[model samples]
Target chain A: MSRRPEPVQVVKERRDAALDTLVGGLPYLAFLGIRFERRGDELTAVLPFRDENIGNPLLPALHGGVTAAFLETAAVVELAWSQLWPQMEGGAGAAAPGVRPPLPRTIDFTVDFLRSGLPRDAYARAVVVRQGRRYASVRVEGWQDNRARLFAQASGHFMMPDLSAGPGAAFADDEAMDPAPPASEPR
Target chain B: MSDDQYLRIAQQFIEALPHARVLGLRLLSVSPGHAEIELPWAAHLVGDPATGVLHGGAVSTLMDTCGGAAVMAHPAANAGAATLDLRIDYMRAATPGQAVRARAECLRVTRSVAFVRATASDDDVERPVALMQGAFTLHAPRLAGEAT
Candidate 1:
């Protein structure tokens, strides 16, 4: 009889082939339910609006806390799309799939709100003014409908990590471990 | 809670919103998305121990509110919307023992969205210490007569 090969222990796994840069995040951001979608230069996403988020009554709108969250999400996602296109289009990025580096650390960001958000679903769209070698500039716009009035707008500057250093990421312990088995897994 | 009370709503916002702290953020004035707000340099807001500069989070909070109010003051949709997201980048630490104020203006407002830009500084508006921009949505009515 042929000798059986030793069992191979699956030590690592991934969702989209190679999304290394995506999973590494601070505990606070994960706690806040931030999501990133790489959809090319024209990026869009929805922040789940909840009534309980109102914090400051003096300004009285959707608390500024929530507003900042949206801006941060858009910035990272926009860059991802720009960086990921080649991979998706069957170039170099596609071969690696999920091994992209973590987003560059932010250096400085500026946000301006033209109007207050009422208690309603909000949508956001981002347009990049310039995506350069060391830094990238983006303009994100949030709205409910397309009534020409915006809920918020954002512009940000981020410092790209050296490719050799690979975004200098540190993963949380809990996040580093394997996710629990799904309920549908065979017993 | 008097309906006619002329006091600024900063206290009430803190009283009800447990997770959201004031962080020494104060309103200087509100004029059609063109407004001024302040951040007091206190013990709790300091991030560094040696020089005692204000924390980045504190400046971020001030920017968030100042920008939001600037948008709310827009003439198009007075009811207000919700904040889908906000992002801030700290240029550097601020000088200790000095209060900082921000000047904000609404750049544009759509039926569904509002845009704003702001600058923060201690004694100089020309050389801003920090820059901020945000977007807001409009509000619709809930059960009973209410404006959220």
Candidate 2:
């Protein structure tokens, strides 16, 4: 007889799949070679270094705009993951793994350059300062080599998607019809 | 510097930045305390594939670079400068397939800082896609015989 999959295992798989889909949906993120690593509900964004990402050839530093983009991506992805976590854990109102909620729209973002972003693989983590039904505020810190020595930090205000309209209604125009799975298999 | 000389220096300055090349940012005009740059639409820069809208990050990059160029062009801030803090507000999605232009002005320059404001617009100049304000650290030129 075949063994049935445990309920906890099924939930975990669904959550993982949804997270992948969410990140895969953003084409610009793919272009920048940004990936996410999830540990339980926490997520860390990684930006693999490429020559094209260099701004100052003399310093060989990562582009300041690219660094800001990385931080913003981290904040957006973290917010989405956090929103999906409760639904997955409850395992009741969960949408299918392929069907994701609309990505939040950024209202304003502010980035502070603490140091030059070294030309190397960089990492970032975002903290949600406030999350409400209509608005959310997130802060992100990016570092290379050392987590304590942040090269840059950013704060963003986002206008949350209005989910009350219906499933996928808010993002009907923006959602990618065919979100290709990431090229690299998840480790 | 003559207008032609200033233009050449600005173009060279922009070309030196690798990220500007990747984004296809072209210098349109530059004068003391003012600069304008343009980014032509490309497939790789699309943020929303379904809507064909350019990504906000692309716009941010353009505005940031334009702001820096403005700071660099300022008579009082001809030396190197780095962004200290930048804030951007998105007003609406950019019209797809249209080249976006960013114009920035250096509003003020203090001893060690320069203030800049910028706006990104498409063909419709009346409504801008985004607005930005930033402060940049003004680096003093190296003096003769200074340690490298």
Could you report the DockQ of all the candidates, in the order they appear? 0.14, 0.38
Model 2 error, position A85 (Å): 1.9
Q: Write the per-residue lDDT of candidate 2 for residues B17-89, one digit (tens) a residue.
A: 9988888899999988899999999888877565677878888888888998998888788567778889999
The candidate that wins on lDDT is 2
RMSD of each candidate relative to the true structure: 13.3, 7.8
Cα shift from native, residue A38, model 2 (Å):
0.5
Candidate 1: residue A130 lDDT (0-100): 85
Q: Can you tell me the CAPRI class of model 1? A: incorrect
Please compute and give the TM-score of the first chain of candidate 1 against the native first chain: 0.64
lDDT, residue A72, candidate 1: 57
True contacts kept of each: 0.22, 0.52
lDDT of 1 by residue, B76-146 (tens): 76674455445454544466677888788878888887776778886534445677666666663232224
Q: Model 1 Cα displacement at A117 (Å)?
A: 1.2
TM-score of chain A of 2: 0.83
Query: Could you tell me how far off, in angstroms, the CA of residue A110 lies in candidate 1 after the best superposition?
Result: 2.7
